[model samples]
Target: MPMGCPFLSLRFSLFLSLSFATSSSPFSFFKLQSPSSSIPKATSSDLLSLLASPSHSSSVNPSVADELKSCFKFLVPFTPINTRSSSDFKSPSSRRSLLKSLRDEQNELIWWPPEPVLELARLAFDSGGDPDSIHRALDPTVMPVPDVEGSKEDKCELTRTPYGRRFISQELNSYLEYLFKLIVERGPDVGLKVSLNRYDLFHGHLFIATETGRLGILFHAKEYPLYDKQVFPYYLGYCQKDSNVTYDDSINLRNILWLAPLPSNSTQGWIAPGVLLVLDAHPGGIVYRDLIPEYVNVVRTIYEDDLGNVVVDVNYLNVGDSQPDYQIFIC
Candidate 1:
């Protein structure tokens, strides 16, 4: 188990007020509420249990339970961890101040897709194996191609599109395949298998972002500049190393996928979910051990009541590892 590594099993306890007003919608009570002393503090275990069996929980009000069930129905396809032993898990190290600053700065530039694209994606998922729906969702008009420049020396011949450059139709096809393998067809034992040769498609800047501050799937590409300019330099300075190094020098931002929550909301703060694929981070070295826990801490802190009380299960497969390892964080 990855828990043996110590770093992989990081836990966090975040206390927030749960006093919320009841919404008109049957399951809209998950909305964030004002501070109240009457309600009991909800723990990670409490939320996880509710997700496992929403109808049976008596600890929370029926409205809250219903809302949580509705919000997390998308998680039905994921494998549930029946037994969690936190004895081996340690609290993530203190990087809160640094993360807060990053959140505040990057929150300004967070992006989302148009409503039509999101609707198409939803249609595709709902329609299951319908090729037309899938094609509509993956279409360049619905899914904007990344604005990247390509070179003749590149391994594959690049085709220029109005939005960006890609290798014929391979990029879109690969992205569709990746979505099915990583999310749609995911099962108890399935983990995203990313071949190094097709790293661009498998480990690209594609991510799932939520309006309620949740940044799902992968890291936002807009934050790449933040890391390259500020975060990376600070890390080098902390180690008393040369400060001239860039983020790309240490790890390829393109190859790293971050699944967490946004520090805050975007301009249009309505509750909507969208997929963002920004091809900016150039491929580089492997992600470091310390960085993963840093991201987990960010997720634990930034995730508010947008989706109600929920647990985030993060699984990663590093090069040469026998199998993918995982850790669970409550958000």
Candidate 2:
């Protein structure tokens, strides 16, 4: 529900492109093509069907009741933002309506949107201030930012679009440096500037990502046909409170896989309206049983639904011998 909102999709068409080039017109470049014309993938109706089924009644233990919370890290309770509370903005009615979306829209690009840290970083960069001074001016929690402050102006130039740049004048070796020069040919403001390699998924135990919120531009292929007809796949991952781990993908919970679902941790899986999770499987993955107590219990009853949605129930959180002992992220 704030101003100048940022952060927000992907689909099965991933095999085609990695760089996000928005097609100006309705062209095949952006529009997703179906995987197989016949026997299409499952939609939200499947989950609703499962939930609505008599077999889904309160059981002694849910098929997924024993999962752990350590994986998610927080309880991101998203509340809808409506008309009355949005009258605060001074912009035209259109922009004001956007401002009013502060609550319900669930802007996922805003990891701790209240941090106001990036905006401060932007202001500092634009002001041509020292990185040291800028670093000192920030929240100690997310400090030591990109570390561009004290670097030489000649060494670190502000791209025309504004985010600071580590200019590489040399093109002696591979053209990668040249490519870097070309990629940001515009500026970081055009989109996220974090390193795609820094995505850190293949290297970590748990893959976690969150924002105070982000926009639900489209439904996650896995969680398709969202909760409502107008529903989209907007979710703010719960941050990790116990460990120092951060998520591997974009913090913005917009749909990453545009068409069919991303591969699941199980042999095959489907994620639906009720908390669908893609857990990394490995000793070093984020929700390893040894690392967290509740995770141990969760590993016990975890099963993929007929459609593959993970159905973790509350009892999983209350397990005795392996109840999660640490507080992860604050949803």
Candidate 3:
């Protein structure tokens, strides 16, 4: 969570207001509305109901609605922070005790707006093209990456290995760049700014600055050798393993990307919790599988279940395969 420059922070916020003016104030601008305005104030329960209901009947684009439903079903229970409460703690003393026990678990429970998902989905569907198309338009060779010594010519490309190649192929890299720009272009409409924070080749982390938040996107290549039916748990186990063979000295396992929201103070100086999205590129296309439960499980095990994480994934182009469409795994 490196600190971003002040300019980056300002730009993100500024762009957000411009891009998302229609929906940015669901939380912040509530206080400014005139009392006599015909618009009714929205409650957390109301919002929850809206989110839980399928958008099949709505006038929204079918693709956008479908994408929204896929991504937001997991977030139905979350209430706005200003009006949030827990039924478990009945008494004031009990609430204080619970808070003390968890050392600010309440604070970690963050509230997020749902409008962005719809907006993002709109953009995705509007493109009229899929990730597969983008993937096919580029060269197949895995692009070479420079070595740690700042010499690309002298050292053999570290990512040239079969697994590495799959992880950072030229097409995927190009798609990544395109996606970043597309997301940023919506900043002004969404009332936030978007910028690149940094790309740490050493850690394989791509950081982005969005509105008042920063996101760290990790490139993960699923190892066929390590594949398991219970994929999420297995990946976490692998992330926890030490670098050495078991039953011997210390062995540190390679880090796998865990699905979670941006940290409180994530990349750059962003303080807001950004959205957590997963894109899985298989031979068929890029699929957006449901990872909400896995993300919550991982975050809760490592920390308290404060604010839950928001999960979003892109819909893949149907490649005429028998593989079923990705669905929301309600838990």
Scored by lDDT, model 3 comes in at 0.24
Off by over 4 Å in 2: 1-66, 74-103, 107-195, 198-331
The number of the candidate with the highest lDDT is 1
Task: Encode model 3's per-residue lDDT on 204-301: one tens digit a residue.
Answer: 33322222122233322111112122322122221222211121100001111222222222121112222322222111110111221222211111
lDDT of 1 at 115: 35
TM-score for candidate 1, residues paired by index? 0.23
TM-score of each: 0.23, 0.18, 0.22
lDDT of 1 by residue, 124-168 (tens): 334432434433333243222221222112221111121222212
Candidates in order have lDDT scores of 0.25, 0.21, 0.24
- Output the number of the TM-score-best candidate: 1
For model 2, give the 10-residue run with minimal summed lDDT. Answer: 200-209
For candidate 3, report its TM-score: 0.22
Report the lDDT of model 1 for residue 268: 20
Which is superior by lDDT, 2 or 3?
Answer: 3
Residue-level error in angstroms, candidate 1, position 54: 5.3
The segments of candidate 3 whose C-alpha lies over 4 angstroms from its true place after superposition are 1-65, 71-204, 209-214, 219-331
